[model samples]
Target: MASREAPSPASRGVSANKPLPPTFKSIQDVLNGEGVAKGTLVSVIGVVRDLRRPIPTRNSGGSNHGRGPARRADQSSLTANIDWKCVMTLCDKSIDDENTAQNGATGIELHLFCPQNAMPEVGFRDVVLIKSAKVQDYRFGTSLLSNYRTAIYVYSASAIPMPPKSAKDALKPRPGSKASHVEDDEHEYVSWMYHSMNKDSLPEADVFEEQANRSLNVRDKFSLLKDVGDGGFYDLIVEVIKDPYDLLDKATVWVTDYTENKHFYHHSWDISNAESGRDGDPYGYTTAFENPTTKGWPGPYGKQCLQLTCYEPHASPLRSQVRAGGYIRLRNLQIKYGRNGGNLEGYLREDRAYPSRLGFDVIQKSEFTEDADSRLKDLLKRKLEYKKKLKQQKEAFAGLENTKAVGAKRKDNGESATKPNAKQRRKIQRAQRDQEVQKEKTQKAESLGLNKQVRCESEDQPVSSFDRILNGVSWRRTRENGEEEHLALPFTNIKFRANVRVVDFRPRRLEDFAAGRKMSEYDCLEDYDGGSASGSDGQSETLDSFAGPKTWEWRFALELEDASPKAKGEKPERIWALVDNIEAQQLVNLDAVDLQANQEQLSQLREQLFKLWGNLEECKRHEYDAHLESIRRTKLHMPPPDSSDNEIEENGPEQAGRRPPDKVSNKPFTCCLQQYGLEISEADPTKCDSGEGKRYQRVFKIFGTAVR
Candidate 1:
C-alpha cells in the first residue's frame, strides 16, 4: 500500500513556531492501495500535465423543467443550486509528457468540487502541492477527490524564485481556495522541480503548437440554442445578457438568442421559500418570490438564457472584448447535461489534443461584416418579439393589481380607503414626484413673451416643438405574428422646423469654438490641442503665411430646450445639435479663422451669439464660476462658498435673501433641425476588436437657420 514518507530525525523536534514537514504518497502506492481502502486521504506532489475546464455539477434550478404546460400556483416550485467541478491530470517525474505516457507511463486524475466562487485555478505544467486529497477508485483507475481540509498550492515553472532566495515569495495559493500552507522543508523540492522541468525544452509545448494550428481547419454548422441537443457540438450566435464573471482559468457568462428550450431551467418569481423547502436562502427572497439564483436577473425572464463556462484561451478574449448587450458568435459550443442530468448547459473548452481546424478564433462578433448577416437579423427579430412579450406580461400584471385595488376600495366615499403596503406606497410617491418635477421643468422654459425678439430663416414653415422632433415620425408595418408595429427610420433624409431656446453650448468656453482642420480622413483630430488657443492658434498664423491652407474650422454643439407648452405627463425635452463649419459660418455670418489670434473677429462672434441668446452667456459664466469655487472649497476642506441665490431659495422662508437673481433671457427662435446618424467608427479591415465597423449613432444637427 502507498504510504506517506516520514520526516528525518533532523527535521523532527524543530522550532514549535515552524510548520511540520509534509509527507507525500507516491502515485504507484496510492493507486495500489485503492483496493485495500476505498477512500483514502493522502497528499501528493506531482507535475500538472493537462487541465480541463470547470463544469457545473448541479443544475441552476430544481427538477421541474418548465415546459409543455403553464405551471399552476399549487405546483412544486423550482430553486437553483449551482456548484462547479474541474478536473486535471497529474503525473510523476517518470512520465515526462503525453508521448511517454503512450508508452505505458502512469498518471492519476484529480477531481475538485466546490461552489463556482470557491473553485481554484490550476494551469498546465505547474507543480501542484496537494495536501490531504481523498483517493478513490474510478473506472478501473485511481482518482483523488478534494475535501474540506484539502489545500492546494501551485509552484509555477516560469515564476519559481531560485536560491539563495526563498521559494516562499514564489509560492501562491490557488485563488478562491483556503489551501494548506507549504512548510519550510518543501521549498527545496519545489525549486528543484522547477529547475529540472526548465532544463530541457518539453515536447508538450511543440505538440500544443501543432495541435493549435490543426484546430483552425475544423468547422461546425450553426445552430440556435433552442435546437441544440445533448452531446452535440454546434456553433451559436448569442447576445450576452450580463457582464461576464471571470476566475483564474475560466470565465462565466450568461447569454441568449431569445429562443426557448424545453430542457432549460425555469426562473420563477412567485415561489416562496416554505413551499420550496430551501433554507438559509443567502440570495434571499424578492418580496414574496423564492428565486434564489436570479434575485436581480435582468429580463426576458424564464428559460431564455443559458449559462456558458469558457476555458483558457477563449476565456481571456471573452473577459476583455465581450460586454453585456454585445452579440458574439461562439464556435463549437458543446451542449451537455449537468452532473444531475436535469439541465442542459454550455461548455466552451479549448482542447489541446485533436484541436479544431478553426483554432482559438472561436469568439468573434456575430455580424463580422459591413452589413448585418441573415443570422443576426433573425436574432434581432426574436429579440424584438421577446421584448414585446415581456411588455405584455408587465401590463397584464399591472392591470391585475389595479383591478384588485379597485375592487377592495370603498366606493361609498369614492376614494381608495384600503391602505397600501410599504412598497406600493413608495412606488406611488416616486411617480407623483417625477410628474411634478417634469411639470416644473417644462413651465420654466415656455416661450410666451420672447417670440418676437428673434426670427428664423425659414419663416413660412409651420413650427414644430422639440418633443415632436424627438419622438420622430414613424410608419406602421405588419409583423409575422400579424401584429402591426410602428417602425421609425432614424436616419431618413428628413428635416423639421422647430422653435427652441439655447439653454447651453458645448466646448464650454466661447474661445474654443474653432479647431484645427483634419489634414486627411485618417487624421482623428487627436493633434487639435483640445481648442486651447494659446500656442497652437498663434503658431497656425505663421504656418498659414507659408502653407496657404485653411487651418481652422468651427465645430461646436448647442443644447436646445423646447419652447412650447408640454402636454400632461410629457417630460421636458432637450437635444444637443452639432453645428459644423459650413452651418456655423452661415449662422454667425463670418468666415472661419483662428478666433484667439484675431480679437476683432472674436468680439464680433460674441456679439452675434449675444443677439441669438441675450444674457444666457452671462448666466452660464456665473454658474460655471460658482461651481468651480465650490469644488475649490471642497478640496481645501472648507465650508461651501455661500450663495444667497441658492441658500435663500432652498432653505425656505426663514433664510434672508441677499444674493441677486440671475439675469437669463434666451429668446425663442425657429430653426431647421435635421436628424441623421453619425458614423462613430469607419470600416477598417485591419481592426477586429469589434464587428466590421458599421456602427452609427443617432445625432441631430442645426442647419439653414442663422442670426439675422
Candidate 2:
C-alpha cells in the first residue's frame, strides 16, 4: 500500500525549521478546509476568469463620514482617503467529482484588496500562480487572500508547456460517461499551445491569416439565417433589384438572392469620401471611371431580399455599375443584426487591404462562366413570369374599371349605350398609340444592345412631386347610416393637366429649409401675417422681406380650373403647392444657392411669373364675374312676396332697401382664368347636380418658389 502521509519538509527538499515552500493546493482543498488551519500558507494556480474595475473604498468614521468641523467639504478631500481595489474571479484547473463535473465546476471568487497602483496586470484566461497566499474565513466561505508577503506570477500561454494534472482531469471526461463534443477540445488547445512554444512551430500571424481565409469559405443561404451571428464575414450570390436611393451619399439598395421567393433584402452602402479619407483613392486609380447608366435590377417578383452595406471606399465607383437585373457575388461581408427584428445585415469589410477585390463582382453570362449563364437563365425565367402576372393583373384591373364606368354611365343615362361614343373611340385610339410607342421603345433598346439598360415602364414615368404634400389631404364625411368615415386619397403618380392662375407666391428662406437650423428661425417666418393671395390687381404683391439671403423654397397658391370643355359648368378649384430649390432653379433659371446669396435677383423671377400669369386685376375680374353669376342664380330661387303682405327689410323700416340688393359677392377674391387660357362660361344650373362640385377640383401643394 502506498504511504498515506504527506512528505516531510526535509524529504521535499525544504528546511523544516523555516517553512516548506507553500504546498500547492487545489481550490477545492482550500475551500473544504474551512479556514480551520487559518495560519497555513498555500499556493494556488488558476486562470483569471474575470476582472472588476477598481472601486473606491469609503472612509470609515472619518471627518467626511460624520458631520463635524473636521469634515472636509471639498469633494477632493472627501475622496482623499478612499482607496480603490480591484476584485477578480479565478477558476482552478481542478474539476469536481466526475458526477458533478459534467455540469461545470464553479469558480472561486477572489477579493483583491491591493492598492490601486499595486493591482495585478492580469487579464481574462491568463494563467496565474499565487504563492504564499493566506487562507481566511471570508464573508461567505474560505478564501485565499494575497498580502505583502504573497507573490503572484502570471504566465502567457506560450510560456506554459502543459496545464496542471488536476486541470487536465477537470477537462477530461470520466470513463463510461457520455463524452461531450468539447471534452477533448482542451487537449487539442494544450497541444497547440505547446507546439506554439517550439521554434519549429508555425508563426502565430499565419494562424490568424488562415482563420480569416477559412471564414470566407462559409457560405450561408438566405433561408439559413434566422438571427445574425457575431459580426463575421460571409459570402453570398444575389441579384440587384432596385436602383440605389442615396441618403447622405450612402447608397441604399434592395436585392434578392432568390433562395426564397417571399422575402426582399435592403442594404445601404456608403459611396462618399467620408470613409477612406477624402484624399485617398478608393479604387486605386489615377482617373475615375464613368459608371454605366442602368435603370436598376428588374423584377418585383423574387424571393428573400437582404440589405447590404458597402463601406469599402473602392466600391464607390461600383454604385452605378451594379444595375437592376445584374447578378453579383459578394464576398467577405460582415453580418450583423438589423435594428428590425431578427433580420441580418451585411457590411462590406473595409478593414482589409484590397477591399475592392472582395467587393461586388458583376457576373456576366458567358460561355466561360457556366454558372453565370444558369443564373441569367433563372433571372430571365423569373422576369418573364413576373411580366405575365403583371399583364394579368392589368387586364383584371382594366376589366374592373370598365365595369365601374359602365355602371356609372347606366345610372346616369338610365340606359346603357350599345355603341361607343366618339370620346370613347378617341380614348381607345390614345391607348393604342401609347402601346405602340412602348413597343417601339422596347424594340429600339433591343436593337441597340441596351437590353440591360431597358428600364421598367413605371420607372420611366415621373413620380408625383406632390406625393409628400398630398399625403396630408384627408377629410371626414357622414354616411347615410350617420357614421363618420375618414377618407384620404391613395397616393399615386398619375399626372393630370390643369389651368391655374398663380394667386400668391411666397419665397422661403434657405435657412428655413436648411437642415439643422434652429426652430426659432422658422418661428420668425411662421409669424408673418401676409396672406398667400394676389392683390386686387392680377399682379402679385412684392414683399421685399419674403426674398432674403436665406431663401431656398417658394410656395404659391393657384386657382385652377379644368381645361376640358366637358367641365365648362364646374366651379374653379384652389390649391397650394410648394416648389423646392431644385424645381425653382429649373423654372427660374437660377440656382437656389446663387439666388440665396443675391437678393436682387428675386425681383426678376417675380416679374417673369407676373408676365406669364397676368396681374391681380385680371384675376379679380374673372372671380367677380363668377361671384355675380352665383348671386344671380341664388336670387332667381327667391319667390316674390304676395302683394297683400307688407314687406319689411331686415336693414330697418327707414330704409326699405332703396333698391333690391344687387348681387352681393360671397367670394373674398377672384382669380384670373385667362392666364391659364380659360374663360368663364354660363351653364344651366338645373342641368348640373349640386354634388358635382368636386368634378373640376384640382389642388396641389407646391414646395419652392421665387418671390420678389
Candidate 3:
C-alpha cells in the first residue's frame, strides 16, 4: 500500500489559534543556551538546508488527532494507521556563516512527529519559521521537537512577496500549519532570508540529494550473507538469531539470512554430537585430543550465521532495539576477513558523510505487507526454509543414533553373529566357528588353553574382517517416491575388535619407527602424528633453533590382513592402521628415539613384536629389499619413464618384482580398531569438484593391544 500524504488542517476543519506577536531567536543563541533552556518553548526562522522523507514511527498509542479510529489497512491514508516522523536541519544567516567556514552543515536539527499525512511540505532553499518548538537534549546531541502549540510557516525562495501594505495582502500560513497568520515583520524576515541565500552556492543541498540516491543504490545492491565476499559493502536483510551483546565502544550481534557460508564458524548442536578424538569419548580421553566446545552455541547449526560488530553511534541504537528473532535492514555493511584470515566477519561503522542518518533500522511489521520489497520477500522465504532444514537435520541425527542403539541391543543378546547385511561379517563368523570346532576336536581337554595366546584385552569379543570393520557404520541412503534420503551425521560412535596378521609394517624397516617431533608454539602435550609424521633427521636446523628441547617419538602404521579362515575362492582383506607414540610404546615397551643409532632399543623392538606376530617383520624386510633392488635395476637400464609394468616384467629376471621370500609365519592376534573421521575440506558440501567434495573421510587406527 502507498503512504498517504497528510490532509490540510483547514480541510480537516481544525480551528486556528489566536494570533501572537512574533518572537524569533538566532540559531546560535538557542544552541548555546544563552537565554533559552532545554524544554523551553522558542521560535526561530531559517532556510531549509536539508530534509528527509517521512518514515513511519513506532506505534506508540496516543490520541489520533480526532481522525476517528485508526484503520491501518486504509490504503489511501497511511496516516490513519501510524504516526510519521520527518527530520530536517535549519540554519539561518548567522549559522550559515559558520557552516560556510567549516565547509559542512552546522545547522540546528528538528525532529517533527505528527499524524501520518500531516508532514509539512517544505523543500530545499525554502524559508521556514517555526514557533513554540521545545528544545530537547538527547543522548547523542541536542535537538528540537514539535509540541501541541508548535506552528510552521514556509515561504518559497522564488515566490516570497514584497512588504504587504494591509493584513489582507500578507501571506497566510499553509494548511496543517498551526500559525494563525503571518506577521508583517515575519514576512519581511522571510523575504530577506530567501533573497540572501544562493541556491547554487549551498553545499548541503547536494548532501540531501546524495543521501537519497545513496539509499536507493545500496538497496539495489542487496546481497545474501552467503554470497558476501571480502572488502565489499552490501545491504542485507537478516534475522537476528542472537541478541546483541554490548561492548564498551561497539556491540556485536549474530544474524543470518538462512544461507550457509563456508567461512563462517561451524556451530554444532547437542543433537549432532560432533566427534571428539581418542575413540569418540564425550570429553576426550586425553588433553592431546582437540575438542571443540559445543556448549552455549544458540544455533541454526552449521555455518548459517554471521557476527556483525556495530560501532559507536550505530551500536547504541542497535543494542536497544534489536532482539533475537527480530528482523532488520543494514545499509553499507562491510565484509572482511577476521584475524588469522580463515573466517569472514561483518563490520558497521558510523558514516561520517551523513552522521544524522543511521545505517541501520528496525524493520517495522507494517512494512512487510503484500507489496513489500522483493528483498524482504526473499528474506521471509529463507527464514521458512531454515526452519524446515533444521527439523530435517534433527530427524536424520536421531535416526542414526537409533540405529546404533538397535545394533548394541542385538550384540548384548548374542545375536550379532546372526545373518547380517555385510557378507564379510557372515564369512568371518563362519570361519571362526569352523576353527573353534577343529581346535576342540584336536586338543586334549587338559591342554586346550595352554597353547593359545590372548594378545588383546578384548580377545573374547567377536573377530571381525577388515571389510566389516571398515563398513561397520556408514551413511545409509534410500529413495522412496523419487526422493533420496540420507542421514546427516558428523560421526558414528562405533568401535571394533578384529583378529588380523601383520603382513606389512610402514617405514618398511624397523630403523625408521621412531621419528623427530614437529615443534609448534602451542604444543604442550604429545600429538598423534598419523598422517603427518616428521621424516627428517632430528638435527634439522628448524628443530635445532627451537628454544625448547628437541625430541623424537614413534609414529608408524601396520598393514594387517584378516587371519580368519576363508572359503576356498574368497580373497583375504587388508587395511592400514596408525600406531602413535603411546600405542607403539605399549607394543614395544620402550620410549621412542632416533632408532637407527640405538641398536639396543631397536633389537628390543624386534623381540617384543616377535611375540605378537612371529617372524612377520623379517619376511616383510626381505620382500622390501628385493623390491628396491628391482627398481634400481630398472632405472640403471634407463627404461622409458612411462614404460608399462608388463613390458618391464618381460625385460629380464633382474627387472621382475620379487614376491615375499616366505609366507608370514605369524599367529593371528586380536586388537582393538577405532573408526573415526577427519575433515578434509571446510568448503561447501554441495560442491563435489574433486574427491574432497565430501567434508570428511573415514580413518581407522589401532589401539589397546599391548605386546607381552
TM-score of each: 0.30, 0.22, 0.36
* Model 2: per-residue Cα lDDT over 1-708, one tens digit each: 232444443554333232112346666666666333775777666665544544433332211111111111122212243344444555543432233233244545555444455555654355555666677543223566555456555545434443222123323221122121222333333333222221221124454345434433322332222223646565455667665434333454556654442222322122333333311112222124323343223334333466666654524644756766566656555676555544556666454532223355555432112222333345444434444555566556657347577668866966446777664676799678756754554444333221121112223432211122234444455578989887553332334322233443332322222122111111123222222211221355356534433333433334332221122465544455445434444444553334444556655654544443445433454455546655765789854444322224222466454433233212121111111111223265533322232222233433222222
Error of 2 at 645 (Å): 99
> Which 10-residue window of candidate 3 scores lowest in summed lDDT?
65-74
Score residue 447 of candidate 1 by CA lDDT: 39
lDDT per residue for candidate 1 within 1-708, as digits (tens), equals 333444432344222122213567655556557333556678877777666555543232321111111111111221123245566677654343333334354567887755667666665466777888887644234688776667778776567665434466666655654535777777756654444332232336555345334433443357788898899877777888877766668877778988988877665546553554532221222234433454355545677777777887677777877788777666667889765577788888875562321212322232232233446567766765565566556657757356455556635546445888554686799668756765564455453554554455665545666654566556565578989887565455668777688999988778889876523211123222223222211245454443423467789999988776666888769999999877887898886678878889889989999888887877787688678867887899987645664565444557455443377776777678888776566576553222367444568899897786
lDDT values for all models = 0.61, 0.41, 0.64
Instruction: Give the clashing pairs for model 1.
Output: 215-356, 215-357, 215-358, 215-359, 216-357, 216-358, 216-359, 217-357, 217-358, 218-357
Off by over 4 Å in 3: 1-46, 51-88, 91-124, 129-154, 158-219, 270-295, 364-381, 399-708
TM-score result, candidate 2: 0.22
List the candidate 1 regions with Cα displacement exceeding 4 Å. 1-447, 450-453, 472-475, 479-488, 518-550, 567-571, 643-663, 681-695
Tell me the tens digit of each residue's lDDT in model 3 across 151-171.
877666556643221222323
Among the numbered candidates, top TM-score falls to 3
